[model samples]
Target: MNMGTRTDSRFMHLADIVKVNLELEQDWTGLAVHKSSPRGDGDCDGQKLLRPLLSGLPPKRLYIHPDDQIDMIKNLTGPGESETEWVLPLHQSENPTTISMLASLFDSLPNPPVPSRRKRIILASVHNDSTVVYYIVHDGLVKPRQN
Candidate 1:
């Protein structure tokens, strides 16, 4: 199947993973999880994106870009529940390069909120083999920790 046809299903797969992962309390809680449609394309059915619901904090939005489209926003989360909503954004990966895409994806977000003066996005990259890698991507430069 072509990439376009595959995109929708991939998002569905990823969303389910995100829901289950959150339910397990891996890093986030499953406080009303659901997907949203992509903004500019009919190809993207808008079911892969997610938003906050009953999180007890505030509302948040999750943006998922197309496979070939990297110049668009990939993820977003509203304020109030910055800490709680930070654990979403799951990307289904077919390979290792998917991890690298996180950088470009995060760069395209539209007016991403800065929680406590820090800008960051959570990436849950699921490989084709069913292995998923989680990452916290910061908006700008980060200082190394001394431990």
Candidate 2:
């Protein structure tokens, strides 16, 4: 893809995603992570895929609805209870890169309290140890009560 030119301002932040992924590759051996490419099929109805680093998190639902959260809280002490995990499944099954990032559990931060854009980065120091993820987001909206 053309990496040398002025890109639209709308996608400016995503471009940083690409840049960080490339720069951080030096810390990882096989995992090739990048932000969703412009040509990516994410806009497709059922074509959502991960961007590598995010795939390493438990999976169930990223954003738990308020009602669901209350239901879960009501049953917090019950057995066989439902649990929530975040699975950042990336698209590498058909891609050339063999590094397919599957589900991973993170030990940082509480689950989402509201639905909004999530910008995150999973990083490690070395030896597959000392790992941490940082999530930064920007959103301002007055959510209407659906209940």
Top candidate on TM-score is 1
For model 2, the stretches where C-alpha displacement exceeds 4 angstroms are 1-54, 58-63, 77-133, 136-147
Model 2 C-alpha lDDT versus the unseen true structure = 0.31
Q: Between which residue pairs do clashes occur in model 2? A: 50-89, 50-90, 56-104, 57-104, 58-86, 58-104
Worst 10 residues of 1 by lDDT: 50-59
Q: Compared with the true structure, what per-residue lDDT tens digits does model 1 show for residues 1-147? A: 597557756566566666565556444444554444322434434434423211212233332223212333343432222344443445463443444454434333333344434445566666666566766556676543321
lDDT of 2 by residue, 22-81 (tens): 347423222333233212222322222333222222222233435555676898832332
TM-score of 1: 0.46
lDDT of each: 0.45, 0.31
Each prediction's TM-score versus the true structure:
0.46, 0.24
